[model samples]
Target: MTPSSSSEKSFNDWYEDEHIPLLSGVPGWLDSGRYRLTISTTSHAPSYVALHRWTDLAAFDTAEYKTATNTAWRTTVMEKVVKKERFLLQYKGELCNILDTLL
Candidate 1:
């Protein structure tokens, strides 16, 4: 999430304290985590990424999840500060190669 300095504090506060908690209530939602990139080829790369884990994509269709994401704060941040990109993925489980380098 890219937030202007003025909105940064509120945005981060709301995301961490409110947004995630709300989304976590969805039926298939397992976890939600955020990260900031420490390395990038250019500034245009996303500064932050949010990873939301769910049992399946069907979780997104729930009314609770939809309502939670359609709030005023989300609209404000999306319109004025952050441009979000979403990627739907499947977890392949842990890497278990016995001889793989630990690098």
Candidate 2:
């Protein structure tokens, strides 16, 4: 997530304080986290990343989650951001080992 400098404060506040909490109540949403990249070769690369965990794809099929995300505030935040990326991923085997190797 790379928010415009002007909207950075608003984006962070809405995402951390409101948006994430709202999404948590949706069915099959396991958890979520936000992070910033410590190292990057390109200065224009995304500075932040948000990881949202779900039980399965069925989680995203729910109307509740869809409705929650399709709000005015969400739209406003998205429009203000410069760049962002979303990934839907599943947990494979032995993530702890992979993390150890990478770190």
Candidate 3:
């Protein structure tokens, strides 16, 4: 997500204080983290990214999830976002563990 320069602070505050906490309460939501882009190969890359892990896709369809996403603060913050992207990825299998081999 790329928030407008004018709304950067508001976006950070709302996302960290409100959004993450709310989503964390939803069942099957395992963990979440937010990161700022320090380096990127493409200029079009967003300034920020958030990753969320869930036990299953069904967690997203729950009433709690909807309530967390549909909020006044979210609406306000989103208006300031110039670019955003979302993806739901499924875990396949771990390819290799270097640490295991080393041990």
Candidate 4:
């Protein structure tokens, strides 16, 4: 997600101090991390990315997850996001094992 320049600090603060902590308390939420895009080739790429891991897709349907996402601070911060995207990917087997089988 990319926040407008004026809202960058607020976005960062909300994400770090509030959002992550709240989500971390949810059941089946394994871990999460945030990253900045430093070398994207696309001109309009979002400035930030957040990766979250869960035990299963059911975690997203939980009350805790819903509560964590529906906060006033998240609403305010999200309003300033110019672009955002979300994807849920299932984990395949290890890369090394796959590569060895191919070789």
Runs of candidate 3 with Cα error greater than 4 angstroms are 93-103
TM-score of candidate 2 relative to the true fold: 0.81
Q: Judged by TM-score relative to the true structure, which candidate is superior, 2 or 4?
A: 4
Candidate 4's displacement at residue 17, Å, is 0.7
Best by lDDT: 3
TM-score winner between 3 and 4, please give it.
Answer: 3
Task: Give the per-residue lDDT of model 4 (tens digit) for 32-91.
Answer: 999999998897888999999988888889999999999999999999999998888988
Every candidate's lDDT? 0.80, 0.84, 0.93, 0.92
- The best-first sequence of candidates by TM-score reads 3, 4, 2, 1
Higher-scoring candidate on lDDT, 1 or 3: 3
**Would you list the rank order by lDDT, best first?**
3, 4, 2, 1
Q: Supply the global lDDT for candidate 4.
A: 0.92
lDDT measured at residue 56 in model 4 versus the true structure, 0 to 100: 80
Query: Lowest summed lDDT over 10 consecutive residues: which window, candidate 4?
Result: 92-101
Model 3 worst lDDT run, 10 consecutive residues:
87-96
Clashing pairs in 4: none
For residues 1-103, could you state the per-residue lDDT of candidate 1 as single tens digits?
6676677777788788779989988899889889877898887766678888888778889998998799888777766575556678887777577777664
